[model samples]
Target chain A: MSRVVVDVVLKPEISDPQGQAVLGALGRLGHDSIRSVRQGKHFVLEVDGTPDEAELKQIAETLLANPVIEDVELHLTKD
Target chain B: MRIGVLTFPGSLDDVDAARAVRLAGGAPVPLWHGDHDLKDVDAVVLPGGFSYGDYLRAGAIAARSPLMQDVVTAARQGLPVLGICNGFQVLCEAGLLPGALTRNSHLHFRNRDQVLQVERADTAWTADYAAGQRIVIPVKNGEGRYVGSPADLDRLEGENRVVFRYVDGNPNGSSRDIAGVASENGRVVGLMPHPEHAVEDLTGPSTDGLGFFTSILKAVVNA
Candidate 1:
């Protein structure tokens, strides 16, 4: 089995409704100075079979990430 | 069947999310973000809302929630996982799906009923619709545009992974006018619109969103 690390990042300057809502709630509670906010996900996986970069790429495009709103990186993690 | 809807500290739509699941003829289980268990639900939904207050990023924080460990595991095991809006952000952040949600090109929050073309209907969450069907659903979000490198976008298009695309106008300036996507396994799906809010005619803008819920049900039953 091979271990892989995947990281996804959202594009910059997108309005984050969740973040804005938090800032709004915080401001209502008297906290301030929040300039900006964003969100993303990171994943580690262990898969069986011969490690193939092509298969990994397929995973990234199909299930691992949305090409439209996100960018993803897949790295081989030495076990 | 039981469907789990995860709720993080900042989640805004857990109740509505659970309601949608119930409306679709499944039991809705509220899974806590800090818990690492999925309650063995048949399917999972990462509902839209400000999880972790969108701190660090829209889904960056919630992606690391304790419950996500199980979500990732179940998804890898071929369980159906659907992420909507903020949930879509979490899926990308959790590395359960590809692509990323970015700020709208206009840098403004958009909320309206948007029309979308179903590009792929083979996923566990989208099997009920035809490939070329157009549906309307509620889409309210701050960071919703989908972006990727030109080459990467081409790969997605070439592979038929682009599941949903905007029909009338690009809502958030997503490249290729993409609206949603699914995993190659057809077990997982993620989208920018709020399908849960469109299940009923009286409450939802149109009944088009019901197909999403029904699609998953059919996929699960068939599997």
Candidate 2:
């Protein structure tokens, strides 16, 4: 079996209010050293055998992430 | 005229959209997201809701549904389409319109009576209103802020494709205060406001939203 992992993050230019809110909370908690925080999504897929990188890329690009406002990175590993 | 109102699994305002169509003197045809047929309707409306539980992103899953493929094809052929709130998110996801609706900058679910200025009344969805007309409509969303690259936004403004702009104050921190935008041909329009809810004076903040439904009727006639 194989596992495919995908990370989706907003584009650099796009604003991440959730991350901002978290950063604010962190600052309030005395974590002022953290200059920034950006929130994103992580997904894991378990495949029967060897995971196809191209197909996973298509899934990440088409459904898992929006190209207009997001960037996706995929990693595969043997289960 | 027969107007099609698409109902996705989590669509919350399909009924109200249909009611708006009926009030505008058009037959409202209910369309399902899983179905492939459009029922030969003259226009289509993607209503607001948290489709697919907004899993990957708002409007991401629903935009790839079977019905949206047909909607995209028909919309490209000059069929009039209106997307309200989450529907507007779907439109952007489907690539029918430019830019993306993002999370509100304030990190809150804002629901309020928003005033919008009609920037371009030439689109199929805004023909009933004259340019510079201000209308109050209810906007309810957590991720309704519109964002795009500077160059694309400049092009959109230069082409006069921005259909509506926030007038009194920006509601969700949309870039350039853009509340709605139209396709190049002026057939497809997506706005982050609940016009369907404001169609009737008895329930809505104002009846200004009726113009969106009524404008399609005139657009069909003129086409």
Candidate 3:
């Protein structure tokens, strides 16, 4: 068995209000040195056998993230 | 004329869209997201609401539905299509329109009556209104802000594809105060405001939204 992890984040140019809110909360909690916070999504997929990088990339690009505004990264592991 | 209103699993505004069509003197056909058929309707309307409970993204899942495949194909061929609110997000996700609607810069769900200046009156859905006319409609959403690369935005402006621009004040911090946009051929339009909710004077902020439905009827007749 193999496991695939996909991480999706809004492109740097796109504003993330949720992440900004989190940063605000952190500031209120006295984490003054942190300059930025950007929110994203994480997905874990379990496959029956070995995971292919190209197929996983296709999945991430087609469904996991929108290329127009978001970037995606994938990591695979054997189980 | 017959106009189709799509209903996804969590769509909340399909009924309202149909009512708007009826009020505008067009027959409204109900379409299902799970179906591949478009029922040969004259035009299509993707209504608002949190489809698939807005999983992944606001309109991500719904954009990949069976019906949307047909919609994307038909839209490219110059079919008149209107997308409202969540439907607007779906249009962007489906690549029928440009730019993506993101969370409001203020990070809040905003609901209000917004004034918009009509920039292009030639689109299938905005032909009833004169250029530069201002209309009031209901704007409601958390992820309604529009974002795009600077060059793409410049290109859209160069092509005069921006259909509506928010006046009075920008509600969700949309770039250039854009409230709506049209496809290159002006057959497809997507906006974050609920024009369907504004078709009736009794229930809406104004009856201005009836023009959207009426415009499409005229577009079909003239086509």
Answer with 2 or 3, whichever has the higher lDDT.
3
Candidate 2 Cα errors over 4 Å, as ranges: none
Stretches off by above 4 angstroms in model 3 are none
**TM-score for every candidate vs. truth?**
0.75, 0.97, 0.98
Off by over 4 Å in 1: A1-79
Candidate 2 docking band: high
Model 1 DockQ class:
incorrect
Q: Residue-wise lDDT of candidate 2 within A1-79, one digit each (tens)?
A: 8988899999999989999999999999999899999999999989987778888899999888888889999989885
lDDT of 3 by residue, B150-170 (tens): 999999999999999999988
Error of 2 at B189 (Å): 0.1
Estimate every model's Cα lDDT from 0 to 1: 0.81, 0.93, 0.94
Worst 10 residues of 3 chain B by lDDT: B100-109
User: Which CAPRI tier for candidate 3?
Assistant: high
The DockQ assigned to candidate 3 is 0.88
Task: Residues B28-134, candidate 1: write the lDDT tens digits.
Answer: 88889898778888898888899877775689778877789878888898989999999999988887777777778766788999999998877888878998989
Error of 3 at B75 (Å): 1.2
